[model samples]
Target: MKKPGRLLGSVSAAAFAILASSPALASGTLAGSTITNTVTVNYQVGSVAQTATSASNSFKVDRKVNVTVAETGSATTQVSPGQTAAVTTFTVTNLSNAALDFALVAAQQSGGTAAHSGTDNFDVTNVKIYVDTNNNGSYDPGTDLEVSYLDEVAADASKTVFVVADIPLSLSTGSVAGVTLTATGREGGTAGSQGAALVETTGADSANTVDTVFADGAGSSDSARDAAYSAKDDYTVLAAALTIVKSSKVISDPLNGTTNPKAIPGATIEYCISVANAAGGAGASNVAISDPLPVTVTYDSGYGIFLNGTVTSGVCNADGAAGGSYSSGTVSGTLSSVAAGATKTMRFRAVIN
Candidate 1:
C-alpha cells in the first residue's frame, strides 16, 4: 500500500508559511497586554471541501519597571554661615509601565578630585526633604506635601522633591558639601508577598494574573521588576570678613609749630581710617565707609583729605577717584569691591575749635 504522500505534512507546512508571511499574525505586543491566536484547517475529500477551527491560545505581556532621577535647580548654590541655602530640587520619574511606590534616601559625600569636590569638613543642619505637591517645581513650606518616601507614581509619570538645608554657623568659609539623592523601588506588603502585578484586563473586574511575556529574564514577579536611580547637587559656603580701625596724629600747633606739635587750641590733628578684609573670604561689594568730625573740632575747608595718598580733594581714591567723597562734617566713600586680604586707607585733617 502506498503512503499518504505526506499530505498532512504538506498541509502543516503550508499553514505555517501562511502564518509567517501574514503581517496581521505578527507576534509582538506592548507590556501588560494580552495576545490571542487561533487557526483554521481546510481540506478536500474527494472534491468535497471541509473546514474546522482550532481553540484560541492567549499570552499575557509582563510588566517592566524602571526609574530615573535628576536635579532640577542650579547645580551649585552659595550660602553664608547660619543661613538657609537655596533649595535643591530633584525630579524622580517612573519609566515603568505600571504604578508603583519608591523609597527615597539622601547622602552627603566629601572630598574627591573632581570639580566642586572638597572635604565636607562641616555638616549642614536641619536638612529636610519635601514633595512638590503643588507641582510648582519649588519647595513651598506649609503647602507642598511632605513624605518620607515617594507615594504611588503612575507609569511614565514623575514627582518632584526638594532638599532644604541650613549652613551651620560653625562652617568655615569656602567649605563645600555634596548631596546625593537616591530613589529605590518599594515592594508592596509583607515579606514574600508579590505586590500588585500589571493586569492584562482593563477597567474594573480585571483578573490578578501576571503577564509572563514581559517578565524579567530572571523570571521574578512584577514587584521585583523595577530598578533604582540617583542624582547630585553641591553647596559652597560664602564667608565675608570686614574690619576697620581709626588712628590720629597731631599735624601742627599754633604755639609749638609743626615740630613737637601739641593738642592745644589752634592745633591741627590728622585722622586715618583703615579698612581691611580677612583672608580667604568672599569679596565685599558696595562697601561704604563714613566718619564724622569730632564735636570738639572744626572742619578745615582748605585742608584736603587724601584717599590712599591720592585724589586730594577730601575724597579717597583707593578703589578709584570716585571711590571717596566728603561733606561739611562727615566723609564717606563707596568701594566697588574689596577682595580678600585687601585694605584701603582714608586720611583727613581737623583743627581744634
Candidate 2:
C-alpha cells in the first residue's frame, strides 16, 4: 500500500498544476463574483475508513477602476482660418475590471506651450464632442453621434472621440490653439443612460461587498489615482499674407531718349504694381489688381497693359504678356496665382497730359 503522506503530496501537486494551466480572464474575475474555496480531508484510522471532513470560505471580488486617455496623432492638426468643423481625434480606453461611464470635456489653454511644439494664442469656437459611430477612425460631422459623455464602455475596450470646433476668421499663419480632452471615470453597469460619478471606497474591505479602487495614472491635466485622465492637442493655422506696392518712373520725354527723363508734358511714364506673398504662407489664387489712373496722365493705348510680369530687386519688369484692359479711367488685370514667397508684377506705359 502507498504511504499516506506521499499520496497526499502527489495529489496536491497535481491540483496546483491544473489550477496554473487555467487561462486568465481578460478583465480578471468579475466584480461581485463570489469566489469560494473548500478543503476536504479523508484518512484511514487504525486500519478503518473514517468520514471525510471539509472547511469552506467565500468572498466577493472587488472592483478595480482604471482608465487611459491619449491623443490619436503625433503631429499638430493643420487648420485654416475661418474653417468650420475642424476636428482633433483622441482615444479613451477602459482599463477597469467592470464596465464604466466617462464624462468628456474639451478645454482650451491660455498663453502657454502647446503639444508638438507651439504656443497657444487663440481659442476655437463652438467646441463640441462626438463619438465615432462606425469605427472608421475619421471624424464625420453629421454621421458621427454627438454626445456629452460615454456610456457603458466595456472593460479593456476603447472608444474613439472627436473634438469638433470652428476656427475664427483672420487668424494668422502658424497661429496655435491648444486643447485638452478630459475623461472622468464614472459609475458603470448601466445601459443607455449615463451613470453617476465614481467614488473610491475609503474604509476597510468587506468580504461580502464589492469596493471600488482607483488605479489610473497621471495625465496631461490630471493627477494619479484621480479616476480621470487627459490628453493635449493643438491646431495650427495656414493662410496667405499678401501685400501690394505701386511705383512710377519717367522712361522718356520730348528732350531725352532712354536718358534722365522727367515727368513733363508729353513724357512717357512707366508704372509698376507688385504683389508679394509672405514666406511660409499659403498660395493665393485668382488675384485681381485694379488701379484708377490719375487725372494728370492719359491712357497709353499704343502700349497696352502688361499682365503677369516678373519683379526683381523691388522693380517690376516690362517683359510680360499683353493681357489687360484700360477702361473707365482704370487699369485692371487678373493673375492666375501667386505662390508663397513669390512676387508678381503688372506694368504699363502712359503719357503725361
Candidate 3:
C-alpha cells in the first residue's frame, strides 16, 4: 500500500561524496531513484498512523580484460619460452553517497585454467568486490552478495583488483593465458539496507560485479631461441587444441550413477572423465572443467577433479557454451604438447539431472 513508500538502493554512493560534490541538480547518482555501487536515501512521509513499508533491489556486472605473457622479472633469471608472467586490473567505482556496500576480495576463474596458486604474491585477497549484478552500468538491489562487510568507497573513488596470473612451462606452453573471470559481490553493510534474503528473492541490479580486464605482452627472459614480442602487449587467443584421446564415454553409466554418481546434492547421474599422458600431459597448470555443479563441489587439484560439483538449481549462463554434459571433459592443463599428437585419455564424470 502507498507504493511501499519508495525503495532504497545505491551501489557506490559514498564514492560520489568523497570524490567531489555535484550541486545544482542535487543530481547524478543521488538524483536518480536508483544508483549502483553506493546506497543511501531520505524520504518524507505523511504524518498520521500508517503502515511501515520498505523496498530493496540489487545489481550485477560481468567484465574482463586480457593481458600478454612475460618471460621473467629478474636480470639473473633467463626468459624461457614456456614460462610466462602477466597482471590484470579491475576497477570498481562507487557513484552512490552511502559507502559502497562491498569490498574487493577474491578472484574466481569463471572459465579458465589460471587459478589461485600458492605462488601468487600480488593477488588481491581479503576484500569483497561488487558487481553491477545486471551489467546495466548501474547498481540496484537483489543482484548483490551480503556475506562480507564493506563501508563506502566514497563517490568518484575507485578500488583496484590486482591479479598476477602465471603461465605453465610445458609442451602446451600457453598459446594463451587464462580463461574469463567474474568478480562477484552483494550489497555491503554500508548500504544500511534491510540486507539480502537467502530464500525470498533474487533480483537483478541487486548484486555487485566488476568485470574489466587489461593484459600486456613481454619477451621471454631466456629466449635461448628466437625473440617474439619485445614488450608486454594485450592479446586474445582462441582455445588451443590440446591433445586428447577418449578412453570412456558412458551416457548412462548406471553403476557410476550409483557408486561414484556425483555425490553432489540432487545429482541424478555422474560422468567420470579421466585421462593419462606419457608426459603426465600438463605439469601444474589450472585445469578448469566446466559443466554443472548442482549442489556444491570442490576442485581437487591433487586429482584434477571436482569432488562436489553438485546438481544444483542455479541456471546456467551460456547454452552450449559451458557444455551441458561432461561426456568428455576438456583439458586446459599443463604438460608437453603431447608430442604434437601424443595419445592421452580423459574421463569426465557428469551428474544427470
Candidate 4:
C-alpha cells in the first residue's frame, strides 16, 4: 500500500543523504532529471590547514502522473429538440511533472440524476468528441479537429475538449440528457504518435531509472490515483409544445331557430378548434388548421368562417377575422404565430344536410 513517491531501499539511508535542495522550476521539476548534493568538510590540524574532504549523493526524480477533467460551464447546456451538433465543453489539465498524452471518452447517462439539478430522462444521439485545436475556447465544426486523444500535452498545461451530439425530436420541454467526459493518462516522449498506456511502478524503485506514480485526485466519476479523471455535463430541452382541441355545438334549426334546437336535418352546427402552446416553451410559427366537412354536413356559405380567434372559459369567441375559406368541403385557416402560453382558435358554421 506504499505510495510511489517514497524513496525506496534501492539506495541506503546512509548512502543518499536528505537535503533541502532540488532543481526548482515554476511548474515542476523534470521527471527523470538527476538531483545531486555534495557537502565538503574543512578543518585545521594543529593550527595548520588540512586537506578538505567531500561526499556527494545523487538520485533521479520520479515521474508524477496526474490530470484533471472539469466541465467548463456552470449550468447545463440549453438545447432544443432535434438540434444537431450541440456542444458541451470541458478542460483537461496535465498536472504531472512530465508531458503526457490523454485518451478521451464521452459517455451518456442511461437514466439517473444528471450533473445539474435535474433528473436525466433521455439520451442524445450521434455523440462525438473533439479537441480545440485552435485553443479558441469554442467549438468550430471544420476548424476544430475531431480527435480521440490529446497528443503530448506539456506539464501544467490545459487543453479544451468538446462533446457534440444530436438531440432527438421526440424529447419534450425540460427533458435532460447527461454526458460525461473522461481522460486517461498515457506515456509521452515521442513527437507525433500517441504513446502507450502508463503503468504504475511497483515494488522497489530502480537505482538508476525514474519511477512512475499516480497522484491524481478523485473526480466526479473516476477514482483517485487512477491516472484518469472525469467530469459531467448535461443538455436540457426547450422546444415548443403544442396541443389542439376541437368542439362543436348545435346552433339552431330551420323550424326552432335559436330555441331548443334539435339535431334535425336542417340544424345549424358551429365548430371551434383551439391551438395552445405550453408555458415557458418556444413560440410556434405558421400554425395552420384544417377540418373536412362530414357526409351529413354542408359548409354554410352565409355564415362564412372565422380565423385567429380567442378562447375563454373553454368557449371560442367570434372576435376573429374573416380570413378562413371553404374549398372542396373543407375549412382551412392559418395563424401567423402563436406565442407561448397563448391560444388561437378557428371557428366555422355548417348545416346538417
Best by TM-score: 2
Of the pair 2 and 3, which is ahead by TM-score? 2
Q: Sort all candidates by TM-score, best to worst.
A: 2, 4, 1, 3
Show the colliding residue pairs in model 2: none
* CA lDDT scores, all candidates in order: 0.64, 0.86, 0.31, 0.87
User: Against the hidden reference, what TM-scores do the models get?
Assistant: 0.60, 0.83, 0.24, 0.78
Error of 3 at 21 (Å): 11
Better of 3 and 4 by lDDT: 4
Candidate 2: how large is its RMSD? 5.5
Report the error of model 1 at residue 16, Å: 18
Task: Write down the TM-score for model 2.
Answer: 0.83
Q: Residue 15 CA error for candidate 4 (Å)?
A: 19
| Structure candidate 4, residue pairs in collision | none
Residue-level lDDT of model 3, residues 142-175, one tens digit each, is: 5533233234444344443333334333323223
Backbone clash count for every predicted candidate, in the order shown: 2, 0, 114, 0
Candidate 3 overall lDDT versus native: 0.31
In what order do the candidates fall by lDDT, top score first? Answer: 4, 2, 1, 3
Residue lDDT tens for model 4, 1-353: 21223333133343344432555543367788776655556889999999987655567888999899999979999998899999999999999999999999999988889999789999999999999988899999999988889999998899999999999998888999999999999989586777899999998876468999999999878999999999999999888889999998899999999998988999999989999999998888889888988889999889888888899987888778898788998899998788989999888898898
